[model samples]
Target: MKKYLPLLLVVALVLTIPGLNLDQVSAESVDDLNKQIKDLEKEQLELKEKQDGLESEKSETEKKIQENLNKQGTVKGEIESIDQQLDTTRANIQAKENEIAETNKEIDSLNNKIKELKEQIEELKEEIKKLQEKIEKREELLKDRLRTIQKNGGQMRYIEVLLGSSSFADFISRTAAVNIMMDQDKAIMETLKEDRITVETKKTEVEDNKTEVEDKKVEVEDKKVALESQKQELVALQGQLNNQMAEKETLMAELEHEHEELHEIELTLAEEQEVIRAEAEAKKKAIAMAERKKTELAQLNKKEPAANSGNPNGIFTHPAKARISSHFGMRYHPIFHENRLHAGVDFATSTGTPLLAPADGVVSKVGVVGGFGNAIFISHYINGQSYTTVSAHLSSMSVSPGQEVSEGQVIGATGNTGNSTGPHLHFEVHIGGYGNPVNPLPYLK
Candidate 1:
């Protein structure tokens, strides 16, 4: 023992060196894990704050959307009311047009009657002219008779002439002559009186006809004017109703556009919330993993070095028993209709098909994750390197966050949820952590 004193000192010195001591290295690794946990916690807090803000924004957007719907209802009602008014106005206009048409017909009839009356008056005037010529002839005959009587006997009477008659035959003959002359005069006067009465009657009839026609025409004209005025009023009312309807329709369109925009904003905010939530969940998983590793380091004799420098093919296994439907790369998105990164591999399968874990991992997130729908995220450690696997668009989840799962363990059932086109599993491999998506085809067994 005395001869091995130097060797004992060398052994003690080797143990005392910090690089060779297992506990020291383990302590340093634990410190690093603690720092990682603290940093993850800080990031989680920030994510939580961001999630709260996104939620508030989403709530406000939903409120606005509801308000827009209410306003749209009101605008639609107003439009309906305007439509009713337009219908009524159109009916009224049609009725007014009918009235005007009837009035025009009446006026036309009255005008025709007035024309007939004018013709009748002209005929009466012709009769009056013939009667005037007859009266003139009678007057001339009477004047000639008076002139003859004055020339034959200036002061002699018929009675005195008869008394001076020489014989009875002469007296009889004179009486006969006087009787004949008187008869001729009486016939002439009778004819003159009848013509005057006839002329006066014709003049009165013509005047009466003219007065009746004029009255009827005036009344019909008044009715026509009134109808035309009413029609104009109705037309003006219809125009106003149409304008109101147009305004209401425009308002409805604007409201609908605004509603669509609000809905889009709500979706965007919801997506943001899901992103923040996923980030927070990722941070929590990191903390848990670091804590678990720190505890394991305290008990283990030595820590294993990272193998393969984070190579994927040696770490992961096939996640689902299905054929590959799509590979991770830039492709035209079926839903969004744009060229974008696929970000994952799609496994074609039927709905409710079990989704297996790609490796031994802890479930980091289990819920709706934006477009992923009922998705699950697993935090994996492969040969001391961090990795993450995502199982998205799930119909159901069997594992919850923070639950440990082994390789080939069922974590969920695949379905067509979120942005998927059909029932399939959208599986992603992130070599470092979340948000770093890589082609999972090369990594799968």
Candidate 2:
């Protein structure tokens, strides 16, 4: 009997050690899960910050691109105006050239007229010289004739012979003829004066023509100088226009390049933002699923307290006096239209339905929660087994966290709050705030 007792004690000790080992392993697993959750949360926060920065950059890039586009538009308008001005300047230059050409043609014609006038002046001078020579020779001949007449008149004293005989009648006729010759000499002198007057008038006409030619040459030279100056001005204006056009082209090119770059950047930012948004959405969904799973696990662990505790026979009361509208497990949701696990039981109840504590417990949490509205959580012990229960979708909570309450005490009121199709109570049970959900029906009945 003593030998058997030692063997039994050894077996019992071995069994206890395995249980202890299992407990330690469970604790380690929980710690690891907690670490993973914290790490994921930190990653989510960092991702959010990155997304924000990306969004800000995207907005700034878009603003820059818009500004560049506006500047480009303004530059294009200026370029158009410059083109118009250039065209106008070109037309004016052409017109000026035409004017200059016409002026040159007129100057050429005037030059020809001046050349003809010079020729006429030279011809008039030759004619004046020839007339002067002829006058000089005639004067010489008249002088010789006058001297012969004077000498012959002195012999006229022989007229005394004419008075002595009939021959004297012939001598008297000769004296009368000599008197006519003297009158002829006086008429010749008057004709010579008239000829000299005519030559002087021809000389005066030649001088006037020469003066007119000189005036014409001076006018043509002035016109040429004015046309040359106009051409120079036109050239300068053309150069200025060319420079302006070149500058405008460069500016336009720069703006276009900047705009294109900005557009590319904007596109990149947009794509990045899309990626960030997708990631954020995925993260949010994952987090929500994890939270739901955590709650479900806690509920399961609560119901299956025998798995961790020796006491297997324990019971808990219903959290509220309500009829079950929806059961746990997979069901098609009317709104979501997909197969989903109803993590908690849904109870159909009137608004302001009183929710009682299912067991003697201390309130662990009381606050408004997303998708649950006002909620209350209670921590309790049954046969040395710790458990937690939650009442969600409540209109109000009457107890504060850490407040003790007896079983059957009203802790909250049920209502249609947060993601509810109707007034109802969403109830859950948990053990150690972790582990899978267990069937609550076994405990309620």
Candidate 3:
């Protein structure tokens, strides 16, 4: 924030100054004016100090803003990196899902094969059961044949049948019958043995098929479990990546907000510095004006003889033979970009144009005067009124302070010097004192 110390000083200085009695002169008033001028100079020094402080503050704030920008840039890079991680995680998750799906398909296939194998085992069981039944029936028939042979005498019965036959032809028929009986018993035993072997083979095949299907199913199930675990891991990775992205984004937002705040502070500090600098300049000018007034008043008390007494109306002649380019008033300043007091009338002319004294008066000031460059001040006492004329922005000066100069006398040549835009004569008329400015056009002859 800008302090208005300079403004307060202006008010205090104005109040301290007593109204001048134009006809009388006093030494006490001049002393009081001198003390006020000293106070203004002191205040101007303080304003400059304050301006320096503001400049330092502004510089620090700008540094902080730059640091914040750097942090934001780093955060942006982190966020981009997180985005890439998220992309990779998402892709991995999709791949895991596909693998799980393939595992599930494999499991389904194994299950189908197990079911078919079970059906095949069941059919084999049925066949083994039928073969066992046939073997049991054949064993029963062999046992009956053995009982019949034991009941009747084995060889004697056969011999009796052969003896009862009437001829050899009858005996041969009995022998053929016995041979056919033996062959039938042998065939039954062989069939029972073959049925037992076939049952064992079918049972073994059923057990092997069941074991193979179960093994395949277990392998497929294990694969599914692994795929599911991997998928879960990928999902977790994706979540972590998302969290990182969100955190980076949040940090970036905070950094951006901080940058904005610091930037605003820097701008405010700069504005305050500008205000302080401008106030300091005003204070400096005030001191100079007060000093000039004090000198003029002191000179009046000495009762110095009038430098010239030719003009009756106390009007001034033109300071330069040129047209008025700018009039005295409040107007927009081209360099400062603000509405400020022009303070003087400007005469358009080329470099080295002769500048003349506007009135017959004593040269009160002749030197470089800050922004005014090589300047001249002439104090005029006419018709019981005090006036001071100022001619500034000179390329060369020919007059000296306290020298008596006549109206229309060449005191200097104008040029584009010290705060001027071009080579021209800047003329000002101050009434009663140095601070009280008035339009010189009205007083010009």
Whole-model Cα lDDT per candidate?
0.73, 0.65, 0.71
Give me the runs in candidate 2 sitting further than 4 Å from their true place: 1-45, 149-191, 276-445
Worst 10 residues of 1 by lDDT: 300-309
TM-score for each predicted model, relative to the true structure: 0.51, 0.47, 0.49
Candidate 2 lDDT over residue span 118-216, tens digit each: 787677678778877877876887887867657768445345434544565676676666566656667667767877998888778767776776787
Candidate 1: tens digits of C-alpha lDDT, residues 1-445: 9666434433443343333554444655555555554555555566677677777888888988898899899999999998988898899889888888888888888888888888888887887888899899999998888787787774365666777778999899887876777888898999899889889988998898789888988988888888888888988998898888888888888788677657656764675465446545544444444344544434331423223223333456667778888888998644235787878988898999988887666777787766677788887754445677888889998997668776677877899887677899999987656656899877765
Highest TM-score: which candidate? Answer: 1
Cα shift from native, residue 223, model 3 (Å): 2.8
User: Per-residue alpha-carbon lDDT of model 3 for 45-123, expressed as tens digits?
Assistant: 6656767777788788788888888888888988888888888888888888888888888888888888888888888
RMSD per prediction, one decimal?
12.7, 23.2, 18.4
- Please name the candidate that would achieve the greatest lDDT relative to the true structure: 1
| lDDT (C-alpha) at residue 306 in model 3 | 32
Candidate achieving higher TM-score, 1 or 2: 1
Deviating ranges (above 4 Å) for candidate 3: 1-47, 149-184, 274-445
Question: Which pairs of residues collide in model 2?
Answer: 162-168, 297-435, 297-436, 298-430, 299-429, 300-436, 300-437, 300-438, 302-431
Please give the distance, in angstroms, between residue 158's alpha carbon in candidate 3 and its true position after superposition. 7.7
